[model samples]
Target chain A: MLIKKGAEADIYLEPFRNVLHGAGQGKVMVKQRISKRYRIPEMDRQLRVSRTMLEAKLFSDAKRAGVPTPLVYEVDREDTRIVMEFIRGRQVKLILDSLNPGLRRKLCRLIGRYVARLHRAGIVHGDLTTSNMIFTDEGRIYFVDFGLGGYDSSIEARGVDLHLLRRALQSIHFRITDDAYRAVLSGYRREFGKGAGEVIKRAEEIGRRGRYIQKEARACR
Target chain B: MLCLGIEGTAHTFGIGIADSKGKILANVSRVYVPEQGGIHPREAARFHAVNARRVLDEALNVAGIELEDIDLVAFSQGPGLGPVLRTAATAARALAARLGIPIVGVNHCIAHIEIGRLTGRIHDPVTLYVSGGNTQIIAFDAGRYRIFGETLDIPVGNCLDVFAREAGLSHPGGPNVERLARRGRRYIQLPYAVKGMDMSFSGLMTEAVRRYRDGAHLPDVCFSLQETAFAALVEVTERALAHTEKKEVMLTGGVASNMRLRTMLELMADEHRVKFFVPPSEFCRDCGANIAWTGLLAYLHGVRQRLDDTEVRQRWRTDEVDVPWRGK
Candidate 1:
């Protein structure tokens, strides 16, 4: 049964068995990239296939880089689909505001640390929003949704990735943005080490370029 | 009550008269065309200053109202070239001072949205405002209009304009590019960048230009550019629409005049079973009518702008201001 009709993919939850790693019965989430009738058929197919492969690669790359991500059990290249381990945990987006200040800070800090790990390995979680995260009952954060992500080690890509996260915090969790962002920065600085400052500075610069920071105003000229 | 609005944000100097009932009495604009290159802010401001009296008088004459009969004055107060914004602001202040009426400064971005809503009679909409310098998807929530998504780097319209210039097209090249795109059959592959709801057009622009220089057909490159950029925009707008669940969608700003964009958005809106609105192209572009209407909305809501507080904010953002006129 179709569970969620996302723009890029439709998600389905079904029972599965991990035959490769011993008999383990569990639920797996199958995400299929739905084709759009609006896009030209040729380009649409090309994008779907390439993006599906890209996302699967991102999952493995991120996992190997020390980030906790859902394991990709199977990939259907032609259908542009993936069957991955289903995360049975509360999404960070829904529970963020309900958490105590201390817990919130710790959770946000963990999120920052995971992002640092991804950047350190030259990967950007492109859609780095709270909704794209799952806070396991085990007190760990698992990143999801590599749909928009790309494999790039450039500082601009890394910085833009963080900036996108900051924007998410401001828009969705406005109340705790100040503390949440600061804690995230602290954790990032701690984990990222020598290269953290440059990425952080670039992130700030990227933020300024958006409509929000508009310092030098000139247009249509 | 009647309010006269002045718009000189970039290259156009316009004057429009509107009543409190959201009726536009008269809207006249004089666009300053640069001689050789891009618009020079100082020259544009001088154009606005020189044409201010005639434009204001003509607007009043067209509105069938005397200067003394005006109840308020409004002007575009920002996110634009410094000299241009100041020129419009000075004209508005002088008009209000001479007429002994209150004055309000309108945010250029919000003005575009308001004009669409007011004219289209749309209650609330996911607005895809695309212009040469700005591309923002906005929706009203809580007590203010918030940006759902926007361009991360250069806006979509700018991408087309720059590519047009490189293709040896004249200034204001969007239309010329669109015309050429219609005749092209091939779709040269171009970069399509959409990160969540936000889009990045610089890469697409760079690749399209590089393809043109690499011996690809000009029309093919133009077609590919439009296809890629417009698709990215439509995709982002669809995301915003899905997220907000707004029943209506609006397309406005300078780029709204493109028929292909309108068709693409219309199709997307149809697929989602949502209403699609595009105010007449005249009111879609940067105009005095939008400023006048937005100012009237703010003024009627009891928002005041003291003379000391009427300074133009070159960095004004759409989400930064409170929309007292709109309710949840």
Candidate 2:
């Protein structure tokens, strides 16, 4: 069954098979990076292969760093597909408004801690939106779709990652974003320690830079 | 009743006369084309100041109505250059004072969407507003035109214009680039930077220019640039469409004039099974008719700006406005 069709990849729910015994296993998600017709064929192939490999590695790294992520079952670089454990949960974005206030705060703080753990491990979830997160029935938050994820230790990269999440929250959950993001910062500071303050500061600076660029563009116009 | 709208947000200073029924009786614009490079705010403001009288006269003459026939005055109230916005605001203020009519300050970005909705006969659409200064995917949700996605860095049109300037093309590089891209066959690889729903075109522009400087064919470079950038735009618009689930999709702003972009958006709309609408080219570009039409909407909804409250907001956001006209 087709799960979702994104700009870069198409997600499908397929049965996982045991290769050794030719036995049927449970369902798994197959994320295949489709070839873009607009790009040169060779370049498109190269990008798909490299990106598929990179995403699989990043998912494993994130899981090792204490963040909950879908376990990778297999990777087919030739087909630009990654078969992973299918997460049975609702997207956080869809359930945010329905969540109780206390539960929402707790969930946001948990997300912040998970993000801190990833940052400590030098893994950045490049696309950190509520849609990229899932809340399982077990009360655990699982990150999914690491297509834009990367290994980066730079403060700028980490800051940008947080900035992207902040923007996503602001756009998607405008009413609760301010309080939710504050809880996230509190949790991040508690877990990440001294570096957390600096990263937070850098995120603010990055936001200001975006506004400055917009102002400059307007002035030029 | 009639409204006279003054638009001087960017390079164009226009005067449009429209009735309460949304009929544009007259629309005239005088754009400030720089000798070279991008727009200079001061120069553009001066152009508006110099041409304001002539444009107003032309619009009134075309409408065959005297100044007294106008019942209200409107001006683009922001999200634009400070100097340029002030120039238009000043003209609007003076005209309103002389005519003893109410003045309304309208959001320039919202005006674009309102004009599209009015002229194209589309209601409650997910708007892809792409212009020289702004690029945003917006939808009316929760009593406001909420921004679903936007350019994280430079706008799409600015990227195109700057790249064209670097490539030695004429000003307003969108059309010229489109013309050149028609003859190109090769699809050179350029950076496609769409992060979530937001897009970044500055990197793509830089990469395209670098390729052109590295002895690549100009036409090929232009084609790659358009394809990559427009693809990013289309991707974000599609995401917004999926998120909002609006029944209609509308395109507005100057960049909507590009056939390639229009075709891409049309295909996306078709796939989503939603009605697609784009106003005529005259309505697509920055024009005073949009301001006048939107001003009428606000006026009918009891939105009136006092003389003291007519200040221009250079950084006004589309979602900041109450938009009571679009009642819940």
Q: Judged by DockQ, which candidate is best?
A: 1
Q: Is the docking of candidate 1 incorrect, acceptable, medium or high quality?
A: acceptable
lDDT for each residue of candidate 1 in B65-91, tens digit (9 for 90 to 100):
888888989999987878899999998
Report every candidate's CA lDDT. 0.86, 0.87
Stretches of candidate 1 exceeding 4 Å from the true structure: A17-24, A211-221
User: Highest lDDT: which candidate?
Assistant: 2
lDDT of 1 at A194: 88
* Clashes by residue pair, model 2: none
Fraction of reference contacts reproduced per prediction?
0.29, 0.24
State the displacement of the C-alpha of residue B182, model 1, in Å, after optimal TM-score superposition: 1.0
Candidate 2 structure quality by residue, lDDT tens digits, A1-221: 88887757889997777421248577888899987654446556877898899999999999999999999988998889998989999999999877889999999999899989999999888788899899999989999978888888999788888887887888788889888899888888888888898899998876665532585655654
